[model samples]
Target: MEETRRPRLAWKIFKLFLVVLLVAFIAAAGGVAYVWNELQPPHKGEMVSFTIPAGTSSRDIADTLETKGIVKNGSFFWLYLKYKGEGARFQAGEYEMTPGMTLNEVIGKLNRGETVKEETIHFTVPEGYTLEQVAKKLEEQNAVSATAFLQLADKPPTALSEVLAGPLPTDNQVRHKLEGYLFPETYEMKKGSTAEDIMERMAEELKNKLSAIPDFDSRLKARGLTLHELLTVASLVEKESAVKEESPMIAGVIYNRLKAKMRLEIDATVQYALPEYKERLFEADLKTESPYNTYLHDGLPPGPIANPGLDSIEAALSPKDSKYLFYVTKKDGSRTHLFAETYEQHLKNIEESKKTAK
Candidate 1:
């Protein structure tokens, strides 16, 4: 009986030794693998972000991370994750990885499932640009292809009118295109974005700017302008005055023209007639017939030429009291206008400013 007890004790000791050896082997192997991985140079690809979806297997993730240069070896990464019982913890979404990222950093990114938003470049769409004008500006940056962005404007269905409402006519006619709606402001857009994307952002900016104004809707209505037409008129006022102080006065000039059934000979209106703005407005430029030339036609042009700012909008709303029929802007930032309850006095102011200019 004593001999039998000794054998049992020996057997128990042997089994403990085997267990210890196995644990030590595992620990050494893990340590060697970690050291080897650390010694390996990062073979990760260019610095760019990528997406990993949820429920991805270790093998698939390893492959994807490898493609993005997040991992040097897929098999090793997969094996490591499985051995550490981390396979089930791998989250998926978007992630940015770089050659500079350590294996540990890659693992952290995967476990956290970081989502990366696309980087975007920005440009400001200035106040007082028509869709055509806006498109041209965008073209200069190689952002979008054409001025066709204006074609998507809100209008009653004439080709584009079917798509969006265009400029609102003075007699309460709504347009099918979006001539007056794209708000002017800075925007961030992905490279190679479509004109549609560009237009949508502008429209969104327009909505944002409009929402901030008090009683904006009523003001638009009272002015007998839709949001689109109001923008058109506002753009005119914005371009006409460099000084904010004179916006209301210039607005009064615009109003006087409308009231007197006279032409608004604003240089800004002439500028809108052509795609390339001429530095000087000539008598010939005034006579040129485009939907935008206020000199050739009587009422506000079919639509706004440029996106107008709040200064212009306020001027449109709160036009100052003036009997002025017309006004000429001066180089010194001053202005001269023809005011007339009488025709004689109106002509006198024009001839006087012209002679003084000479």
Candidate 2:
């Protein structure tokens, strides 16, 4: 009886051992499959930048990877991603993946945000942007407060004094604070920068761009432009001419008008005074007074009409030579104008314009 029991027990132990071996072999096979697939291409290596559309399922993404050759086999990626508990972690967006990247590395990028560090803080301050114009541009981005930008322009930083040798003139009641020195261009800013920082960067860029202006200081002196006049003329140029090539002629016009002691009757100056350049002006709007009236006050208005561009600056330095002491826009709105040195000729142009309008 004892011998029979021993034999039976031994058989039972043998069966248990076989079961253990079977489990071990299955696990080994799985490991081998996983390793074997890793050596192959994702599919065939077609994807450099992969876009996973929104709402893609695990199987769908794996299939896409397989079709693109980004994975040698989709089954392995599926199993691997699932085992790592990353099935739902694959973000939907543009992704760049490579064969050199391990399954773990690719998953990590997706989980962290399929998005590399990026910024959207890009906008421009046009060559002729006034403090108000700048404020409106910034307001569109929400990077800084427009009100704050405008207020700062009214009281430019003392630190800026080192840069703006000829800022806007303060004596003129018509002129506001630092309008012209803002220097217009596109600026990149942090998503959440302070208004002061925005102002400083703009000021710094302005100084740099303007510094390259040859004999800018001497030109400022000759024009009696207390930094203020430069800004004013710059503003005028910015407002008057869209073509950089025409800036010199525009500057010459400003110079000629000043030379003749003529009223620089620029509509832009009127617009500046009204702070509503966007609206169409009636004759009454032109007649209003707030210091920026170039028609009434004469002598270059109170301040810059807009933020002047580099062309305006260059134009101010090198005005075009002409006998034109007066210019009036033609009725065609084709930029055709009448240039007159005599009052009778100028009056004749005005009468012609009225007849055309009638």
Candidate 3:
């Protein structure tokens, strides 16, 4: 009877131990379900705007999100980041978030830097614009002070020194040190960009454009022209060309004249020497006593007269193979030119051009 009592007591003790084990398992399962539910997106809140300052830590970001009601739990978000090994990949910027966004969505936006757009100002610098003209345009657009832009252009930024393919011309008569280096393009900058910033951006664009051309270095070398000279010739072509298709032919004419050691006698150079552009140039204008006046000078002008576009640059590098040394614009409103291999033929073409005016 004592042995029977011992077995029954043992069974009761074993059964009580099984019940405690079952209760612990149920409690553990409930705790896991609660945590998982808390981790999900709230999916019901207005959009919130925040800034993640530079060098902000992931934990701080998580806390900011929780405080803004973008997340249900900062600690859980922090843990999630750690689990995914992505805490260090967040970027700093102004962000807009809605609470409905999931954990993955929030993380993706931070990593991709989907920031709020700031106000920007855009201005276009057309091809063949002189440095002075560019400055004036900037002033008109209220982008930068014209005086400041000109002063900065006079002494170009040192950062641009590396971008140049050759040394900057030190000629006193070269109007501006950065005349032809600034590429012509529409640029967008922050509302308060400085003159140096704009100039540097334009110069860097020129460098990038040159780099994009196939075998540019070899083409420049084969032409036996320095970067400065190439720009000068390109500027000439740009000024002479009213028709884009005629640029290469005009470039060839300039090259032939240069090879023959003849004065360029370009009307554009004379116009550049004048204080302002004139619709019609006179003999006195051609006789202007400036180094930029190609009619008076023997070689390329002191420097490029204006910023040239890419087509003109390419024309200068690879001029059309022609013996033509002269061109006269047609008076027929077509903005085209007639080419000539001799002065006599040029005179005839000039007469023919005049006939079209009537």
TM-score of each: 0.61, 0.61, 0.87
Worst 10 residues of 1 by lDDT: 156-165
Q: How big is the positional error of residue 244 in model 1, measured in Å on the Cα after superposition?
A: 2.0
Question: Can you write out model 3's per-residue Cα lDDT over 1-358, one digit (the tens) per residue?
Answer: 9999999999999999999999999999998888898789987778899999999999999999998888899999999999999879899989999998899999999999999998888999999999999999999999999999999889877786876655889888888989999999999998899998898889889999999989998999989988999999999999999788899999999999999998989999998899999999988888889999988889899899999999999999888989998999999999999999999999999999999984
lDDT of 1 by residue, 42-135 (tens): 7645787677776778789888876766667777777767777776767777777777676667677667766676767677777766667677
Per-residue lDDT value at 121 in model 3: 89
Residue-level lDDT for 137 in candidate 2: 77
The digit string of per-residue lDDT tens for model 2 on 1-358 reads 9999999999999999999999999999999987776645443343377678888998888777666666667877888777778869778887767665666666677777665444558888867667777887788878778888777777776776665645446664744476776778888876777777777777677777777888877876786756666666777877877667766777777888888888888888888788566568789988988677787777877666666777777777667887777667666655556667777899999888766662
Q: Go through the candidates in order and give the clash count of each.
A: 33, 17, 0
Q: Which stretches of candidate 3 lie over 4 Å from their true place?
A: 40-47, 50-69, 78-93, 104-114, 162-166
Better of 2 and 3 by lDDT: 3
In candidate 3, residue 146 scores what lDDT? 95
Misplaced by over 4 Å in model 2 are 1-120, 163-168, 172-175, 222-224, 331-333, 350-358
Clashing pairs in 3: none
Overall lDDT per candidate, in order of appearance: 0.70, 0.73, 0.92
